[model samples]
Target: MKQRPWINVIATEPEEIINTIDKCPSGAIRYSIPEGSKIKENVSNGVGNINFENTNLSVVKIKVNANGPLLIEGPTIIIDFEGKPLKEGSKMALCRCGLSGNRHFCDGAHSKQSWKPDQIDK
Candidate 1:
């Protein structure tokens, strides 16, 4: 299988999703959309019909917390260093801080450490 480039999108609407994902050089392991929303390719672009199958969008979605773990909202295949598959859930928290006892996964260690990183909105 050909390796695809990892793409990160933070869009809420279909138009926004198309615009953002269109910018990626290649598709990613997952494509993130807002919770309770799905990207519909049938939506018209005013000028013409947009073809989603020709696009690089994927079904995987993730939500980034302002001060916490990344809320991955689907089952994503994660491989360990030894090329073994690790069990992931439909909804899981990935560590944002560098102190997770589980390494990549959040172990709620950030709360104990009281680590708050700077926000981009600020």
Candidate 2:
């Protein structure tokens, strides 16, 4: 099987991320695999922020850990659902376990919950 490329976008503006996905090519696809579900492909979302890529600003890099929060690096600004900026930092672990006391931010609940992703064999 061919290895699929992964993309991880970390940005202050979630709209920018969504816009890039929405503008993907014809065959370009995105997936939001549940933590316990089987992973059919070795893929994540776009690896870089489209907004930064288009400008002179720094790009935010991210890693989608299986069954965990998104590992992020570089200067990033996080926004809430209402288009309000929530936080800004150089590194962060955004929640994916849905058990965080602080929503959208990882609070180490995955470790306590013993969460693990259903990974595909290489």
Which candidate's TM-score is highest?
A: 2
Model 1 ranges with Cα > 4 A deviation: 1-58, 119-122
Question: How far is 42's C-alpha from truth in model 1 (Å)?
Answer: 31
RMSD, one per candidate, in order = 13.5, 16.9
TM-score of each: 0.45, 0.46
Candidate 1 TM-score to native: 0.45
Q: How far is 20's C-alpha from truth in model 1 (Å)?
A: 34
Which 10 residues in a row give candidate 2 its minimum summed lDDT? 45-54
User: Runs in model 2 with CA error above 4 Å?
Assistant: 1-57, 117-122
lDDT of 2 by residue, 11-72 (tens): 33444544555443311233353456443322323322222222333777787866667877
In model 1, residue pairs whose N, Cα or C atoms come closer than 3 Å (at least 3 residues apart or on different chains), thus clashing, are none
lDDT of 1 by residue, 1-122 (tens): 12233333432555655555444321222243444555453433221122223233246678766666776644456678999987543445677777777878876566665546335335
